[model samples]
Target: MSAFSRFTPLIRALPSTVPFVGPEAIERQRNLPVKARIGANESGFGPAPSVLAAIRARAGETWKYNDPENHDLKQALAVHLGIRADNIAIGEGIDSLLGLIVRLVIDPGSVVVTSFGAYPTFNFHANGFGCRLATVPYAGDREDLNALLDAVKREDATLVYFANPDNPMGSWWEADDIVAFTRALPETCLMILDEAYCETGPASAMPSMQALIEQPNVIRTRTFSKAYGLAGSRVGYAIGTPGTVQAFDKIRHHFGMNRIGMVAAQAALADQAYLHAVVGKIKKARERIAAIAADNGLLALPSATNFVAIDCGGDGVRARAVVDGLMQHGVFIRMPGVAPLNRCIRISVGPEHDLDLLAEALPQVLKAL
Candidate 1:
């Protein structure tokens, strides 16, 4: 594999990697069709009927670029969150925002802190910027906030990332603890408080909009993907002080927000009743998944998020076997990437049919193992 002759040192030195492997890629590699699409944390229930109607109505209007200022969507969000429109900066998604944040604060070798197996996308951005990463291991299947705080201070980190109602393990910390953690952080370090799963978590797990709004160093990122069923829309927003939010203008793709996606998010926000209904369905699905796991003699970890992590009663190898076994039965699923955390497998909440497939396949796969 011959590389480009004159690439920058940073580009040449960095390893090429994809943070996630979508189920479609697996199907292509194996020459198999996906029977139950439950591997990704996508809402199988999908966006609200109102949202679909909005998209259909606006399909012909896709010719125009979205408002680069994102005026109307920010106004709707401000009313919903009870925050000023000036506090919001809309982006393509949280992934894009993560990269922008890294660009803002990180120089080569700057320290960025996060949990060991926390969202890998944040780690991907850190690596791309040649930032030093300090990771704290999860304590008993949950992000050890105290250990993370310790690592941040010890490294004199410039940036820190924390996700409430986290991914993979699906654990969470209370709102007050998160607020306390923010206050305790040194003013010099900026915190990227990623709240991708906030709507699915308990109310106590989410801090109020007013909680850390005054701090210029604290930027909280939220997405329309998880509960709103807008993962494909790629619409997300960051809440921060006006001056801090303005910093995104320096590097963000001003016209990156697509017209259809913006309208979908706007409709999704207005349909709060639909969101509540789908959340109820998600809770029921979570319960069903736990029941299925329990029946098959696996332990389901407590989750404030939409997915559940199951302790597979062994090491990473055992967890890996389970994931592969499920795939063989056309039940696509995923597990953690590293050890300790990799001792568990992650199952996203999906429709009843998907759950039924998992339930039917588990015992057969275990017996084969």
Candidate 2:
């Protein structure tokens, strides 16, 4: 069959790719059931019981389109964060908001800055908008803030993406350092501080909301996908000055948020007791994952996130072998995409039984290698 001839140049130039393959895709491709769903940085601990109850109560309202303004969710998030509702903009998730931000600021050939091996989705969105990327390499397994700032200045970049309690490698910087970085950036460059893993990290790792909430150039993105155990809900928000966040209203999907997700996020926020409890469990699970890595004679890097990145004691080839071997045993996990970072296989925290599967399979995989 012949393809449609009419298409945008940007669409034609872009290559098809999967930034992060889901476990379901792996199952279909490899024909293996995933015994431990510990990849993709999803919370195996699951959402709070109250959140599920809220979903059930609101399921009947599914026929109605969600409020285009996202009124209630924004109000709830504002109260939760101690900020005005005007300071917030809700989206499907951080990923959706990233796309919107890129669309708002980037034109063809606009320069964007990000860590060389940071979150790929942000990179994907930048490319989709025809922005040129200026990638700064990781310094000692962590995103180098100084280098990132330097690149933004050098390239005269319009946008920059940075994640705190970073993913894949699970490294993080102190909140004070982050505040300094944000202040150091030129006002012309818009900074997206992706705090997707903040809840799982230490108190010291997260900046005070008041510190950067007033900065027009800074937008801090947060999600219910991590410690809140609501990855399926796809609810995330951006915090910035009112004038700054108002830009989203101009280009955002007016009714993109799911009704059920809004209800779940509201309930999830109200039940802080449950959130605190789950955070404790996440911390414990991180420790267990670290222990398993130690038992298998691999070094588990310090993580402020829900997952641990275990150094497999060799290069990307060796790390990949372990990943493939573990998947062969139905214990699914992932690894970093670039060098140095790729020497470590990333594992998400799950219940004891899932870790039990990992504990059983890891040594066997290593022995075979």
Candidate 3:
């Protein structure tokens, strides 16, 4: 039987594929089980015990639809961040929020600027919206802010994505520079500031909520996935002006949030001490990862995020070999997808056992390569 053929041209042109492959999928495809599970930037330290209790207590509410407005979560996050609840919008995660933001601002043929090899999900969302992408190369493993601003000006971009304490490379810019970048962007372009790793970065690396709150063109995204250890809960929020936030109400799935997920996020926010503890653990785990890299003669880049991107002392081929070999040993880790950066492999912060596994596998993998 023939398939229906009336889909939009954009849908037809987009390739059918899941861009970020999960560890579970790799396990199934490669007929191997993941032992360490440190590849996806997930916190193996897990969520706070209070959050787990909250989830368990709320599990019976699974049949209930979550509040479409996500009132409770937003109130909690607002208090946590000392921002007005009106300035926030909740989503399944930063990943979902990025898609909605792209859809909101981008039109077909509009230009979107981002760092080359910064975050694939942002690029994926831009492509899904049929927006033309203008990419700038990274400077010294960090997203080149000046270059990104230059590209946005050159292209007259309608949308731009910036990730401070960026992923894959795990590099970051200070708050002052980020504030300057946001101020420098023309009022004509909407900027998506993805700060999913805010929990793991330096306190000074995150700009004050009030700093960019007045700028309707800027939206800073944050998630519970990193130090909060709630990746599966899928709770993230964006901070912007009320006018900008109200736009999400127009198109977001009103009742899409899961009740248990909301409960988890609220509980997660309430436990500030736990968050601080996890951030400390993440810092320690990062040091362990860097030590493992040094043991193998690889150089780990200084990271402000939860993951460390290590220079494998060779080209992409060597980095890839180490990545593949580690996976073969049930030590799942990832590498950057582009050149220069691709010469490095990224390892997410996890428990001592996971890092122990990576420490064990990394040396053997490097020696074999």
> Which candidate number maximizes lDDT?
2
Cα distance off (Å), candidate 1, residue 331: 1.3
lDDT of 2 at 88: 98
lDDT digits (tens) for residues 118-175 of candidate 3: 8998888999999999999999999999999999999999998999889989988999
- Inter-residue clash pairs, candidate 3: none
Q: What's the TM-score of each model vs. the native? A: 0.98, 0.99, 0.99
Off by over 4 Å in 2: none
306 in model 2: Cα distance from truth in Å? 0.6
Cα-lDDT of candidate 2: 0.93
> How many clashes show up in model 3?
0
For model 3, state the Cα shift of residue 224 in Å.
0.6
lDDT, candidate 1, 1-369, per-residue tens: 886799888888888899998899999988777888777888999999999999999899999998999999999999999999999999999999999999999999999999888899899999999999999999988888899889889999999999888888999999999999999999989999999989999998999999989999899999999899999999999999999999999999999998999999999999999999999999999999899889989999988877889988989999899998899889988888887999888998999999999999999988888
